[model samples]
Target chain A: MTENEINHIFQTWLKQHKALLFKIVRSYAFNEEDRDDLFQEIAIQVWRSVTSFKQQSAVTTWLYRVALNTAIKWTTKERKHQDRHESIDVSQHIIESHQPPDDRLAWLYEEIAQLNEVDRSLTLLLLDGFSYKEMSKILGISESNVGVKINRIKKHLTTKSEKS
Target chain B: MEFKEMKKIWDTQNDEALYVINEDALHRRIKAKKMGTKRKTSFSEVILIVSNLCAGGVVIISHLLKNSGNVAALSMGAMMMIVGAYILFMRSQRIKRDQQTDVSILGDLENAIENINYRIKLSQSMIWFCLIVIAFTMYTVLNSDKSLLNIILISGFFIIGFFMSRWEHKRFNLGKKKQLLDLKEKLINEFEM
Candidate 1:
């Protein structure tokens, strides 16, 4: 594909699905600096994956796969060298919305932060109403495994909410 | 709240974007990042390849210039060239393998492990190769009609190099090995569930 075509497609994806990428970034990275770094990494991955997208799967699913893969790797790599390297300057490139925060959404993100990397991803997919089949495809796991994990994640979140 | 209620909360943000992107800056950043990544890789890998080849050439030329007919120096030069060629080959294969990895989480994890393992093995090979080169270089230096002070300084340089390489391996390669093992465990455990 031509550079112009790729850039245009990337711009379209950003306009339509920036929130989805933000959700993954927030779930994986807690600090503002880390979030910025992860957001850039995921965006870059999404841009790279555009040429490979064959329309065989939904665009959202493909974006999820790219974002999640990049976020997971970024999480691992970040832990190894936290605060050691300079961060990407994302302050001007991307900024959070000024909308008021919802307590429940904050609570949900906190709970997600408590889970393992895989569980965190599963939580996002489950909450967003993705099918087990879609989650399995993005995660490269069996459908049954996705089902089992979703069940456990639901139970964990429910049990935590009851305690609160 | 039940799962349904929680899903409702999550869905509320589906239409409300959380972050705003500066389209022009993002475009510029992506372009610069792409170029920077290419330049970084070329600078590191290409420099290593060229320097190794150049070091080998210099060694061979110096020996020929002095008419020393030093077989040890000649063999060391050849070994350096071989190591450089090996690195060139391995780097190409690594790039090819990297391009083939999909965006799936499992695939990324597997690729990470493979890349780390390759690095660990390469570091091991490099350490051994350095040792051999140091030994042969020392032998050549000693047998040459050099002053006592010169021999000691050259030997001292190699010894310091030996320690530095070991230190680097311990500092970096061991951490990478641990990361590889942890990733392997994560992959296996995720699948076992």
Candidate 2:
């Protein structure tokens, strides 16, 4: 496809699923600067990779995969630096933001934040109503594993909620 | 809470309030890619100037040695080669240094600031090395007499460069520490509120 045509297609797709980018960024970023940086970086990566975008899968699936990978890599690097600088407690940040008082949402974010990076991505995708197949594609995990993991996460959440 | 319960909250939450995509801003950023390219080109120009000066000095010394059989010319040529090699090595290292990635959201600002510090060091080192070479050439031009003056000046530059680099390194570390503390405080306050 021509460059202009490709750009148009990307722009259209970006308009539709741009919120997904924000969701991922918000889940991972610490502040406004980080959010803006991640958003720009994701946009650049998406634009760069648009040429290689095959039509075998949906555009949203591709976007989630790219966005999650970028966010995870970003967070891992930041965490290393934070560990060195000041022994700032990440749990404080996790707990303090948007408490939701009696709502289950805060608990959900806390649990998801506590999960390993890969599992966190999977859980977020599942929570967003992605099918097991779509989750597998975004996560590079098998569909069966996605199903197994979601069930396990569901059970874990239930147990945690009971304790609380 | 069960995944279903959490998902319900996630679904009902005001996503519109949380996420905003300014396409025009994004488009402007993409268009500004050329500015980054321009900065890189300017950096390359500095490298080119140093390399060309070193190369030119070598050619001149080589020609003088061939015609006059002067030991001084040969020594100058050798010195030029050393400077050329040093410049090339530094340029390659600077390029490698620029290629690092900071993917994390919280630490991205710190990493970027550090990268800028690294670039400043590279540039300062390049300038100092070039000045040292020029000082040596001046010493040679004066028939190698009063070599102590050249040595003192070179040492002074080296000392200054060392102190500058140390200061930059300390400042970078402090900035990183401050950023982490700020983020921690913000997060804490956010939780409290």
Candidate 3:
């Protein structure tokens, strides 16, 4: 594909689906610096994936797969290089003042931060209203496994929220 | 705070711009990242191939200039070139494997594990490469001067190089491999599959 085509496709998808990227980054990365780093990594992966996207699935599904895969790998790599610091020049500011974040959303993210990496991805998919079949396809796990894990995640979140 | 209510809250952010991405900055970064990744992917491979080829070339040229058919120098130079070619081939194969875009997270994880395993194997191969260099150098040195001190110095130099590579293997490759394995285990156990 031409440079212009790739750039156009990437920009269009990114503009349309920035929320999915943001939520995945927030769930995977706790600190602001790490979040930015993870965000950039996911964006880079998504950009690379534009050329390979053959319209096999919806753009959102393809994007979720790319973002989650990048985030999961980044999380693993980050653990090894925890002390290493990176300086990203991009200004991706979280505008909490413009649209005030719900306290429950904040609590939800905190709870998500507590889950294991795979479960964290599953939780995001579950919250985003993906069906067991969709989640299984995205995660490459069995549909039965998705059902079992989603049940546990729901119960855990519900019980935790009741206490909180 | 129930699951349904939580979903309601989560869905609220769908329309709202919770994060403001700098379009210009992001575009520039993306453009730069594209170029950087292309360069970064081949950097190590290029370095290894060039260094080995150059060293081999130098040895062959020096022997030619002296008008001497030194079998050891020629053989060692040929060996180095072969090793360089092997590295070029192996690294390119690995780069291709890593670039495969598997849409599933499980496939990505398996690819990641394979990538790290390849790295660990590459580092081990470097040790074997060092041994070849050391053996060739020792043979040439003994042929020229059967001196214990000279032998010790040459062996010491390669020994230090060997240890440095081993240190790097333990410090980076092993740590990354362990983390990837742990991640894979966590995912497998989570899925109960």
Candidate 4:
């Protein structure tokens, strides 16, 4: 495919699924600047990878694979240098009285922030409505393992939310 | 709340996640990225290049000027410098494992882990190669005449280099293996299969 054709296809994907890309980036990047950096990186990667896209699967799945793969490295590589696997715990985010956002989304983001690096990516996939099979496809795990981890992540989020 | 319910709430999440990016700007950046995607020359690599050029120049000049007993030793120094530059150039062109994004996450994850482990291994080997050469070069350049002191100093440098490489591997590479194993355990334990 020509570069212009690739650009058009990518532009459409971005227009429709930019939020998906954003959530993936936000999961890994600490701040706005980092988010922008990762976003550009993912964009460049997707643009590069688009022509090779066989479209055998959903574009969403392929896009998730690229974005998550990129973000995982971006987040883990720095932590790997420090020999730490646990990602930054954003559980302590307090909503100011005046700027009350959606409590569920805030809690959701906080809990995701607290998860281990692998689980953070997996749970985001789960939340985005990917099935066990699709998660397994994207994550390279078995269907059964996806079910197990999804339950574990859900139970943890629920138990914490209930207690508070 | 259950995940589905939370997901519903997540779907309603204001377009706070949205960031406007222009097509033309993205195209330009992609063009720029594609143009500049060569594996960057590392800081150590720059040092290697500069040292090689300067050292090679000095020794070759000394050999030509016919400094007493410097002829053979400086010629050897010049040759080693050429080899050093070649090593650094090859080091910069080291192959990176391609992340197979279109496959299973388990396979991709394993590939990622293997890539990290292999890169660490490459650096360790490179150090050993560079150490021997650097020691050889220093020995030849400093001592034009064969002497007991020359062998002893070179041996000392080799030993020091060996220990340093081991220490560095323990500090950096081992953690990557542990992280990989941890992920492995997390997967196996989660499924109990």
Q: How good is the docking of model 2, as DockQ? A: 0.14
Give a tens-digit lDDT track for model 4, residues B77-98.
6765775677566654543434
Which DockQ values do the candidates obtain, in the order shown?
0.29, 0.14, 0.26, 0.19
Candidate 1 collision pairs? none
**Steric clash pairs (candidate 4):** A139-B105, A140-B104, A140-B105, A140-B106
On residues B1-193, what C-alpha lDDT tens digit does candidate 2 reach at each position? 5556677887754344444565444444333432344355446546645765676576566667667555554565666666566657765665564455333221233234344555555555555665655555555546645577776786677568657755754564345555546544643353231
Give a tens-digit lDDT track for model 3, residues B88-151.
Answer: 9988787777677353332343354455456567678877887888788777888874579878
List the candidate numbers ranked by lDDT, top first.
Answer: 1, 3, 4, 2
Candidate 3: pairs in clash: none
Model 4 chain A, TM-score vs. native: 0.83
Predicted complex 2: CAPRI docking category: incorrect
The model with the greatest TM-score is 3
Q: List each model's interface RMSD.
A: 5.2, 12.1, 5.5, 10.8
lDDT of 3: 0.75
Alpha-carbon runs more than 4 Å astray in model 4: A1-12, A29-34, A37-41, A44-48, A77-100, A158-164, B1-3, B13-19, B22-46, B64-144, B158-193
TM-score of chain B of each: 0.66, 0.41, 0.62, 0.42
Runs in model 1 with CA error above 4 Å? Answer: A78-93, B16-18, B24-65, B69-184, B191-193
Q: List chain A TM-scores, every candidate, in order.
A: 0.92, 0.75, 0.89, 0.83
lDDT of 3 at B102: 55
Residue B61 displacement (Å), model 4: 3.7
